[model samples]
Target: LPHRYPFLLIDRIIELDIPNLKVKALKNVTVNEEFFNGHFPEYPVMPGVLIIEAMAQAGAYLMIKKLKAEGADGDFTVLFAGIDSAKFRKPVRPGDQIIFEIEGLNIKKSMGKIKGVAKVDGQVVCEAVLMAALKKS
Candidate 1:
């Protein structure tokens, strides 16, 4: 939450179903966002990579919450290991709020697989299969 601009893709966590290992997150897009300026002035669309980043953020949040709930006492950092089977179905533009939904596919001690989707106005804009590593912070 203390993270700064550009790095912070997640706006809020809407739901956390720990038993299902599922979470819903959001990112509000605005014209004032820096990326729009360079991503293309005439045709501004959120980058595909940023969409993936948003999904990763959701996965990281879920992992942190799960660990803390179990009273695990170690500093941890989550890092992206890989992304697969990613697809962009629609373009996301400014003034749109993207809903990022992610669910754990499998969880290991230090690594896990998750599936994510980015949606806007009830439409899926992008989705991916993500792998991340959780390590000591």
Candidate 2:
């Protein structure tokens, strides 16, 4: 978590549905964000890639949390194995509350699959299918 900088993407995780292996997190976007300066000077807009990254981070957090709950110790890293069928449906601007939701599809010994979505004010902003794997520390 400390590794994140320039304002963390995740503000808080509201729900963790263990039975379904799903998680819900939030990110508050503001106009003063640094990325807006270069992304566009006149027509500032949040980058689409960042939206996907935010979703991916939420998914990673869930995987790490589950691993920790299962009594896994030491430093274990979860890496993004692949991104499939990612789509940016709408532009996410400042002053938006992005609700990120991720569901665990399959979790094996080291690899896992998750379906993630980012919503702004109850509207879908982005969605993606992510595959991740745990790496040896």
lDDT (Cα, tens digit) per residue for candidate 2, span 3-104? 367746788899997667899999888898899999887888899888877887888778877777778786667787999999998888888899999998
**Candidate 2 global Cα RMSD:** 1.5
Candidate 1, lDDT over the whole model: 0.88
lDDT of 2 at 14: 92
What's each prediction's TM-score? 0.95, 0.91
Worst 10 residues of 2 by lDDT: 1-10
Q: List the residue pairs that clash in candidate 2.
A: none
- Per-residue CA lDDT of model 1 for 10-69, tens digit only, reads 989999987899999999999988899999899999899999998998898887777777
Best by TM-score: 1
Report RMSD (Å) for each prediction in the order shown.
1.3, 1.5
Model 1 weakest lDDT span, ten residues long: 1-10
By lDDT, the best candidate is: 1
